[model samples]
Target: MGLRGRWGGRAAIALCVGAGVWLLVTALRDGWGRADPVASVFGSVAGLAALVLALRAIPAPRPPVPRPVPPEVPEWWVDRDEADAVVRAVRRRTRRWRSGGSVAITAGLHGAGGFGKTTLAKYVAAQRSVQRRFPGGVHLVTIGRDVRGPAAVAAKVAEETRLITGDTVETGSDPERAGNHLGSLLAQRPRTLLVIDDVWEHEQLAPFLRGAPHSCVRLVTTRKT
Candidate 1:
């Protein structure tokens, strides 16, 4: 609560407490009146109200901020027109989020083996323009080409989240539910780009999904078309 709110709550408690005491004093001075059947009950409620107000005056602790690391800019970035194209697409999507315009939730690179898909994805994330678009920071988590169950996926989400933010995510064996929980965590960080690289199946990306279609975009690099 702000200064005004804390003082306002204190005032309310004082008023309620005073009102209750006044009622009791009035009953004692004038015997039990016909309409004064609930003097004790009203006083008890006033005490409870004061307690609640006091609790409300104290603010809750804030969650720890994530410490994200963007991919290091390549020392000698070579001729990769493909990498620039992907960066432009991501820039467009992030702009839509900034403009309050509708945008797709997921976008990334996909290509055959030895085609530099991971390189392009990392390059895009390392770009200055892309980094600026995603103020929350770009977090890269690689899910290599292999089959993984729901539990495995959830564990990955928790591990990466903890690594990036030091916030522990409660993940279950269910990918859908776990995704929702992780998504809520990511939702706290709007405009973040979560890159899940070397994906084999769509299910591999499920654990990283946000509960709502908010500003956080899930970018994946895959061999699949």
Candidate 2:
């Protein structure tokens, strides 16, 4: 069926032909001159038929198919071994956290942004179990940029998450409306994780996060206490 298979099939036929010719020569040389001609011909035919059948029955090589797209595996934080264990734990605990509880992970060389917070958060988001927890898909937004205000942040998150915010959002919609729309979107999805990276202060981002649940865990990477 494939290139390799075709080549193999041709090679097998060549080998069978060579073997049949060698046997015929051997039979003639080893006193087949005294044997019955009809029986000799029938025997040769039967042997060749069986050899061909056996060769044809041999398995053919199948062509390799393209690989499936893998779910994102995050950049490792700390040692690779440690990250694997932590990611497994995070994946396991999403259900518990979404049930109105919280789970906090503090690792790496320091607290907040220095502690590989973003890396771990991404790992959690990418986990198969974690992805299942949020049907709407996890959204990661970096704050403290030019997009500082609540409205700007909402619009940015909506756009980043590929949520359909009408064209009017880019033209003149206020930040509150954008925030409200984002909140509504989160509400529609039963469980979601929104990581607000590099938060200068919790209060600054809180307004935009109003409709999102406590169950909808927010991973914050910040220097502030």
Candidate 3:
């Protein structure tokens, strides 16, 4: 119930309880004697009725709201502890103070192919705690080996931006320009987590890394050392 209704209910309950107590006291003073037998009986009954009304005026408790749950990992995945450790390290790094304010926290997972680096990145991003910090959401984009051209990389970045924001993006053959555009979109969202997967070279990553804002944390996965 609303504030007014709640107060109103409480007031009514108090009034009923007071009335019941007064009636009971008066009935007890009469002692159910012949002096006023009818009044004593009537007061006792009215007291009980008022008490019942008081009890009925109490409000029922509301049910508890459920908390948000993280998405479950794949059944075949077994590196849960590694994913959790990555999450902790990322969070700890984010909490550290930076002179220029919140600095860009870019976490890289580099290893040979088939080592589950991308899988761990996904698992870490899907965590409920990570989502709480990065409410803008974790946007993942794959920059595979074939996507080396400026136009292709730009298109991939724009496509990923469009996928997440649902807003139309205008991109060109300039990789830096496209990354800057995507960065602007990410900045609009508070504490965004951008996962650029399967990065192959410095040329492929520099644009995205340079353009991303301090609020956006980059989790890049690359097979190349």
Candidate 4:
């Protein structure tokens, strides 16, 4: 709660408590046995109001709100020609799959840390041609060294894809089940583009690759070749 809200609640509670105490004291001083019925009733009401106010003064927990996912498009991109070149290359390599073939296309963009590999991948994924080709939509997952392991990576992808049916794959502990579930979901889709970014090891890509559709195009970005 804000400062204003807290102060307001405290003031309300104080007023109620003070009123209740004053009424009880007045009733006792006048001798409750001889007190008027109206005085007794006022005292009871004031005490109840004070008790309710005190209870309300205690804070209740707020429910958690889901965070909004960031958009795939970059805020500002430099070197449009470079991004276009990479996009064209990706399209050329994956063109065979668009012709009713079941070949899975994989491309790696390896460079130094700040070389904008992820940005380029986002640009490619956002292309009209790419979107038109993959009707299932483009999904991006970040699996850096900080990511626990294959299981964690799988769980993250599953969450991003909204594939969590129950507690089967919470926190990505069951990689096999998560991978299989994800794969089954993707297999049902016609085509999809999976962009795996900031990968630190080749092994981290296994679970995601296992679930990807045969006609899907996988774009990987990493500092290592």
* Order of the predicted models by TM-score, top scorer first: 1, 3, 4, 2
Collision pairs in model 4: 183-211
Which stretches in model 1 have alpha-carbon errors above 4 Å?
1-22, 25-60
Question: What TM-score, computed on C-alpha atoms, does each candidate reach?
Answer: 0.73, 0.47, 0.62, 0.57
Query: Candidate 1's error at 40, in angstroms?
Result: 17
Q: Output the lDDT of residue 13, model 4.
A: 66
Superposed Cα deviation of residue 129, candidate 1 (Å): 1.5
Clashes of each: 0, 1, 0, 1
The worst-scoring run of ten residues by lDDT in candidate 1 lies at 34-43
Q: RMSD to native for every prediction?
A: 6.6, 17.9, 14.4, 13.7
Better of 1 and 2 by TM-score: 1
Which digits, one per residue and each the tens of the lDDT, describe model 2 over residues 75-158? 443444655665565444465554756555322211554566666666666667666765545566666646666566656655
Q: How close is candidate 2 to the true structure, as a TM-score?
A: 0.47
Pairs in clash, predicted candidate 2: 151-175
Against the reference, the lDDT scores of all candidates come to 0.76, 0.55, 0.70, 0.67
lDDT of 3 by residue, 1-225 (tens): 556556656666666566556656666876535336555565566566655655665666534323224446778878656687789876655566344656546788899999998889878877778878766666777788988788887777667767756656577778888778877776665666677899998778876775545667788899987
Query: Worst lDDT window (10 residues) for model 4?
Result: 163-172
Q: By the lDDT metric, which is better: model 2 or model 4?
A: 4
Q: Give the TM-score of candidate 4.
A: 0.57
